[model samples]
Target chain A: MTKENNKVTVSRRSVLKGAAATTGAALGAGALGGFPTIWAQNIKNVTLRQFGTGVSNLNDVATKVKEDLGFTLKMTALDSDSVAQRAATQPKSFDIADIEYWICKKVWGAGNLQAMDTSKIKNYDKIAGTFRSGKLTPESEIAQGTAPHTVGFVEGPGSKKFADNESGWMTLIPTIYNADTLGIRPDLIKRPITSWTELLNPEFKGKASILDIPSIGIMDAAMVVEAMGEITYGDKGNMTKEEIDKTIAIFIEAKKAGQFRAFWKTFDESINLMASGEVVIQSMWSPAITAVRSKGIPCVYQPLKEGYRSWGGGLGLSANLSGLELEAAYEYINWYLSGWVGGYLMRQGYYSAVPETSKKFMTEDEWGYWFEGKAAKGEIKTPTGKVLEKAGAVRDGGSFYERMGAVACWNSVMDENKHMVRKWNELIAA
Target chain B: MNNTISPEKTSWMLVSPLAFILGLFLVLPILIIIMVSFWDYNEYNFFPAFISENYDYLLTSKVTLDTYLKTFKFMILVWFFCTFIGFTVAYFLAFHVRTLPMQIALFLLCTIPFWTSNIIRMISWIPFLGRNGIANSTLISAGIIDQPLEWLLFSDFAVVLAFVHLFSLFMVVPVFNTMMRIDKSLIEAARDAGASGFQILTNVIIPLSKPGIMIGSIFVVTLVMGDFITVRFMSGGQSTSVGRVISNEIGLLQYPAAAASAVVLLITVLIMITIMMRFVDIRKEL
Candidate 1:
């Protein structure tokens, strides 16, 4: 009996030592694994290059790709148009592109991006059905354009071709999406600003700013034009030449009268404009509005009665992708849609493509707080674990589905995008 | 003489490395831009075909003309301010300071801000100029005004001020170099001949400082002409510059149009420089 007891104690001690050794090995591997050149000697390696705009949280997803698939994902951050320019003119520079829907349409027109095989994406069927379905609110129904999230596929293969089956292909995979609205400083405005026309209201003269980006800025102006009882666009996304001219003329008239304090060209500029009280109101991204609030400014990303201008970003395979590069690119896409990436992006005010899958990585409270718009059960933190919300703080737009599902119009590349850019330049010059 | 290489050949050898660098980086890119300016582009793609549509549209547009006038307006205003400030500071340092160490120290003080990022320096003015900023608050406390100054932050004044702050150093460096090189004997002779301070400055100093002023003018004029960020940020986007138009066009992926605008800007700047150059032989002076 004494010998048996001694043997049992020895086994228990050895098991504990083994567990400690494994943990230490994992920690060392993680540190050394960051160096691709050293690891490439022992492992079969592929470098998956990517170009994108507004994909900062993807650094974590790159780590996931390295651990799961033994590949190095190199991402280059660029502006929206730069990404399109590179994808269209130099598709060989990158294997994957994180681009907007309209950009994909533009690049796809140039036969630069390949159709994504959805069969390889394990979470394809589990992606939010509402996003894929073409159903729209009554406002959108009358608006007579596809919903922002309705990314249609061509049911085939190759660059331009696509398919909408379980095994079908698409030009891009839906990833991060959000609803955007005007961020307003209520303390300065000192009144309710419910309508988009308020962006142009003379009362706010020299206290309003808009984005300098032509494609997105024109849409915001179009919303204001309609809200101000001017002629409404048939489709705000793909406005006709007449519609664009009419909207730009309104903007030019307003600009001449000093309707804007500044035209912000970047996220930080927009935030600084509001935070420093340079502008009382401006078209702002959700994250920027959050940043301003974090600065202790009385800012609100208001849900205008005209509804939010929504947009989404997705991933596309470059036409130059082949062999191991192609296989690794697909693997990265699958891993990006996995639960952890979705959860990570959700904490940053973006809705994940596959919410059900993302829920696996998040607590029930996090789901309720982020998606259901419930008050935080405990302290809620950002992806990097900075305290974003204290207990009992509620989300701004109520629920993710309610906010994203009711988008008025998606940011688009209009049919008259070139003419629109000229008009936009004229407005700025004026 | 028969065995020795010609002066031209020796000079060419010395300049070849510099010529190669200039040709590779500068002349080649400018030529490519000129070439691309004539290319045709649609919404998505640019085609490498010779066409005058971009230049035609740019040259014909009223907006382009107005934008050029605005840019020229900014350039003239900024140049005047920078030259005046730069000359005063340089004169104080070069002549009045007297001690070499103090002059060098003050000169270094002027350039210390340049060691940091230009963007940071540009943005550091925001808090100072904002409506509720330190300047306004100080003024308000002093009973200088009842209301916070609105124009202090986001108007033409702010744009000019930011430019003078940034480009004044360019003027100072060149003007100071020339002032330091001016013969002290000449100024003493003018004073001995019963010249007043004003007379000495106007006749002896100003005439001798022409090369420095011309060089300083070149730097200031070119910098303000090429600048868009200061105007874009400081003027609250109410102002537009020629460079801003090119940048905007590029951002919109209108490469051909941007190239055309760039070509026009380059020609305009070159003409201005040539006119300035006629005022003083900068190469001969250097």
Candidate 2:
């Protein structure tokens, strides 16, 4: 039972004794919020918990609406999982949450959120039903407990699209989306490493990086394993144990060969690894490419012959609520899906479902660089003063967010995540 | 029974808060975690039932023990280094830094890190040793190194560096207090009785400072024993620490396995504390 010094105690959750010092501090501060007793008399408070891309902009818009639109909007910010976890536990923690779309079905299964009433927000109707699509078709035998409709969009690996028809081709709304590309340094190899095969190249030893998160990373590993015919994982969104083992073997073999420079836990680290040439190419997201391009480095997002993996994040509401709070929540959710918030996230190195609103905010040339995939029309330098003439995704299905409508991976649950993660660990530790 | 002298009944009220906290926060959850470790893991990261397989895999696997051994070895190395350095710094502050104001300032400086969140302090270390960090810039500017050191920020060395930085204060407070309370006249008497300054320090000061040294050691050992964040952050998730293992388990919602690791760590720390109490009462020593 004895273990090493670096063991993590139960500190993250219940291990936090002393009554959660941070929670206490927040409560203490909330006490002094100059909390208008008079204001409390007139206005009701609503909280919306969300994470990452949409947090700040959504908060700002919420504040604007509170001031001008006259709704006392109370918002709490948290990670993607926390949003779902809280809704599962204390149903009254928030009225709305910008949850990751894939998690929505999971939460709905746990009896967390109520079905989104479309009558509250007519805007939900005017927009494409693609945002409201679910993975199970209208006729699928997903126990009656599941939420039959999709609430909004989050970006992920691209797939097919269907109209009004509810099927596996359905997608949630376009949240902030981007492609997971192999960001490679041109100086490393004469020939571009555009395929998964390049990672197994003996020529470039100890010059790779991979994500440490097993969920997404294992999928990438399985993709490579299948491409190499070493493993075939993801059985209709469920990976068998054998398939997982094969993927693990491939990753383990790669590790033993000293193929990786290091592994990155965060988006920032991957960018730093790429920029310094420590890792020539690793599993990287669009933000990292945007960062490297800013540095005047010649790092290119090599559109693989196979395909770049993609991901997205967006919002939902607590199921327990309906009435006016629900209406206010729907407003916030739609505003998030609407141009203002989505557009802001898009221009800041993210692609939006509401591309039109985001483009309206961007300069004509900026729009061309991101969505149109055109080179800089005029002499322009990236945020880091790097000349990005042939800068953006050179491949046709670029702008990882916009194209996610065809992405089958968005919010789709793998049948066997445990086996998938176990396989992932085997791959990394191998 | 003499109420004041009886061990169990005398201080039950004094110990109630801790007992309650442990029962509610630590012991009870640990029990649940033990139950969870034997359950199944889903893609959504849920624990379903008692599927002896998770424990079966855990018990039968050699990698688990290997990771455990590496964690203990890391704790030993980290505890030794931090305690040694901590004793030295605390010694200088107590005996040498005679001015009260300066001592107060130094004490405050040691605690400055505590004022900020732990995460900020850990993250700040990254920039100092990162690819574009000061160490790399200074070396490159001095024409000492051409390329940024890939291993500088997320290596074993980096893990140790971060641990020492975080834990040194735990060492300093007790050692400094122990040194301050020593009879000043004992050193004077030793010097008067034909003893040199070094001998006086060695004979009187060193022996007297044991209480502080032991107390400080307990703090450092326990803290380093349980912390995984510094190592996890510094090593870029390559290295295994008991904390990392437990954290990964928790992330996958494997509560019982994580709990098992935690229980192991807690028991080890409690044993160390008990051993230290024999040399001197930690309460009086502090």
Candidate 3:
């Protein structure tokens, strides 16, 4: 194994050296008119393989990258769990990893990714405060759980340890995030649903669902338990063994009562559960709500009085990346934040990290409807040009500021994650 | 050197390829799983450490026993339905169908659903079994029910329904094979001895069909015992199976725990198959 690894290292070093020599020659050749000759020649050969959850690892993004950036951008989409597993265990298989903040907490310890220099980011200052300081506004209190800013930075370029405050080096370049809430069928329920406690309300018994992914599911359960005045957790993100026990206990009791109609693990499952009217209310993502709406259902991403459980995803460069390949990765990250991808994702109900840049790529009316929470001036369309909402329809959970500012917690990986997982299995068994 | 090879040596040469393939693909992987089952794991990575904690926890946990019992319940229910349905269908095809072409055509008709993906076939049930689905609406319109039956989907009933739907074919093919190969002389002989139709079926046909029944039972038992997706998808993630437990642990990156659960499940399945093997000598029957 050691010999094979050494041989691979030697071959990789030689490849990097050869690429560096070509880059030097290209730099000496310099800019021709306004366009660089490097993009037409050397950079076209650079294929960066990226993998992430199905939400963001889009075919359109890869197409747009080929069109605009002049490189082969290969993308593979997996579920969140598989993404984490691949990022940690098979780091050499990918050049870039688009992963969530909570997943970052798990994958970062593997040291498969190199820390990114924030100075290289063109739109660093324009990025949202939620990713930089765990705040949407100046007065915003940082919510519990693995908020993006907490694991957003490393101490230095080569450091494996996460810094408490922002350092120059970042673990992931902030790309897209959203404040998530439960999706409910407003037409079916025929009543105003509010509060996390509604997830356990007996009226919706056998007509409610929750996500089955243990880490994120536990946070949703924590939100419900706290809302029901059952337990006051010190920090929902970093729960103690006792807190984990209590939270699982509450959900198990509910499960015994047949409170949940189902538990979904994928985006489609949530959409189907709502559209079929099999489930009246459940934990859901922003895009899933849009998907249900696209099917002409009256699905609402209902905001509760408690607040939203938020999560953020970003791009991380592999540790093996170097030479021209590394430069192309940085360019890709810059282009990602530069507006087009941001605009595309935002239209799908996700918030762009560099919101100001994203605003440039969207129409005033589109921007107003999606981010400003204003009623649609006309028929609102998705990035694909499919009509999302008719005129006078308002975005659910209101404006970006209002929704993100009310974030009560973020998806987390607790210290007692193993214990929590075991208890979660027991909940399923029950 | 001998002019001709010995029969024993020729048999070994022929079997070596199969033995080598099984050792590489099947035995090696199982050995690796057993090794990994003893290793230790944390939140992110599993390291190479000889620790029995994974097995220790799995053996002691109440959830493991409950999950096993639940999996067994599903296996038993699915097996019973698949065997009964498969036997009836095969019996029909073997005895009642006069023409060989008609039997083949009808048998092929049963396989039309398998052409599409398993996931697609499984998911298609959602529209038919959902709360406001066809089954519910049809029942309501007929004045047979007032409210939609919630148990039609995302329930234990749905899980068993899907299992029987997907796997009865596994049972059918083998039973049909064995039944078709049975001699007509035995049935005629029983009828000549003044045996009634039911008596001939019980005394002659069933006795001859034991090998086929055993083969079908084994197929249904193994398939249902190891299923996770059917239980997860059909039951709407409410039900737990042994396979689901292993998969859940794997999803969390807990390889050791998953491997430990897998080892236990494999041993349980092997023991069940062994007990089943005692009922009939499959090799001799074949």
Candidate 4:
């Protein structure tokens, strides 16, 4: 029996070896310019568990990941809170996590995530310089020391150079980002809307909606309040208790007067609300606006005069990860920052961190349509190449630099977050 | 003594696995929740503490009372509709249908909706009840109304409709199980005693189906009271239940506050169940 078992095991190992060799040969002749030498180290059979959201094209990216990286990349998609829950309680269960930068401080404080070694990530230097500094444009810079990406870099022992505060590490690697503005049905609203205050305008009463999530939703309210000349916040991202109260009071009044048609919490809900004409205008993600337009609804992602409320998402290594698994993780992160994934995400209405890398993978027409804000040179397709735009359609908000450069607050987790949540609930309940 | 000891030991051995499972999965989690409810939490994270501020805040807040009252309002409304519908359906299946095969087939037909996802089934109401949905368009085209009915969806009416649609099945199964076991002779005897059809139903059928009604009520009340998703989506975020408040708190990482709210909800549900148990001893019938 033992001799027969040994024989079977040997045969299976040989079969796997043959399969690996054939795959390697295929990769050598394929589009990726063959397997890089660094991957030749026997990192096979290592499974890097990724706890993340499919906010980007991770599903499409997963199929190519195993073949390209020579290791299994298993991804488990979770909502933000559930991701935090798993990261805090079972840090060892995953090798890496993809999370929003707004929530990074809390997650890092919980000791679930660790800073990535920038030197190890080959495309780290390729990340847009604007992210490193808080500048949207040369002249219009976000106040110094307020850049979202700088929040997680701790300068301490065992750190690298240029790491502010404590070391040579980063909280997370910027993956996909975008500036968000409201999506509205241009055909329904007879007049033009230029300010965020229009969300609560009595004329659009019973036809406007906002997001139901508190952390993000309150910022939209703050913008409206600020635009209305109700009150100006010192820093909209991190509001104090009084700021939250004053903002929420406006929302409650609006809610009481039936200014909102609905408060949506999910992507599809917002799309359905706009597409069904249940709401004429609402705070929406860009993809959701595109989704509505694809369904033959006349929805436009309106560029408000007050600028866009931007949010960013990125990948972080787990605190417990090290050795071969860690190396494999580093490889995976580099692979993400490499041209393919970045290009894929950019095509899906997100701005990739390494713009140059993404540009290498995009067709000139695709680049013109997406980044240059020009009319499409041809029918624009998504990452999988299903047509998303006709030849004449111009992208909203113009070029990447123009759209992202507009000064506005990012999604935040404030010190008064608890009070904000309470007040926000009252607004919803009202 | 030896004989008694041996049988007792055998019985304990038989029950030990289940007891262990209940202790580990059920009892331990509740104990942890109760323990955590007294802890302290800030914006970033929660910490273990002996403070009762979480409970204090929950008990004193006006929002807590409003949420509980709203949840109870929904619970009572859904319970009324589900019980009325469930009992009537169960009655028809048990009494009106004479053949067993026909009864089984009809019962199976009632359960066909369960084969699909609950979330899908719940959201399907959107197209059916939306402003541009089938119901409104049909009404307009037929000249029944000038404008589409706004209250058909994303209203209190929609929330109740969704709860009834999702949880009516929970009401049906238990009531049907209890009804199937009710003796037919009781109804026949009541009729023979010169009782009218309504009289027979009241005097014999309903009395014997007490356990079923009680059981179904427990299922329905608990399901509606504990539900947050259906109310959230169906009401278009205008409504808040006790459970929704707990979820919102948990979303904000206010674990202590959430745990405290959950404990209150649990205690409230237990009290309701205890009162319901007085109506009929469900365990005896089962």
For candidate 1, chain B by itself scores a TM value of 0.95
- Per-residue lDDT of candidate 2, residues A25-104 (tens digit): 54687764543332342233333343332233345666666664355455566433344455445565655555555555
Candidate 4 per-residue lDDT, tens place, B1-286, comes to 5556677799999999999999999999999999999999875578999999888878888788878888899999999999899999998998889999999999999999999998999999989999899999999999999988988888889999999999897888888888899887877788888999999888878877888888889989998888888989898988889888888887767888899999999999999999999888878867
- Give Cα distance to truth, residue B114, candidate 2, Å: 4.5
* Top candidate, metric TM-score: 3
Cα displacement (angstroms), candidate 2, residue A401, comes to 11
Report clash pairs, candidate 4. Answer: A154-A166, A154-A167, A155-A165, A155-A166, A155-A167, A156-A166, A156-A167, A159-A168, A160-A168
- Chain A TM-score vs. truth, each candidate: 0.84, 0.69, 0.92, 0.86
Span of ten consecutive residues with least summed lDDT in model 4 chain A: A157-166
* Docking verdict class for candidate 1: medium
lDDT of 2 by residue, B13-88 (tens): 7799899999999789767766666666443345567666765665566556666666667677777887778878
Arrange candidates by DockQ, highest first: which order?
A: 3, 4, 1, 2
Give candidate 3's chain B TM-score. 0.96
| Two-chain DockQ for model 3 | 0.71
* Model 3 stretches with alpha carbons more than 4 Å out: A1-39, B1-12
Between prediction 2 and prediction 3, which has the larger lDDT?
A: 3
lDDT tens digits by residue: candidate 1, B46-143:
88999999999999998899999998888899899888999999999999999989999999999998998877788788889998899999999999
Q: Candidate 3 at A303: error in angstroms?
A: 1.6
By DockQ, the better pick of 1 and 3 is 3
- Model 4 misses residue A41 by how many Å? 5.0
Report the number of the highest-lDDT candidate: 3
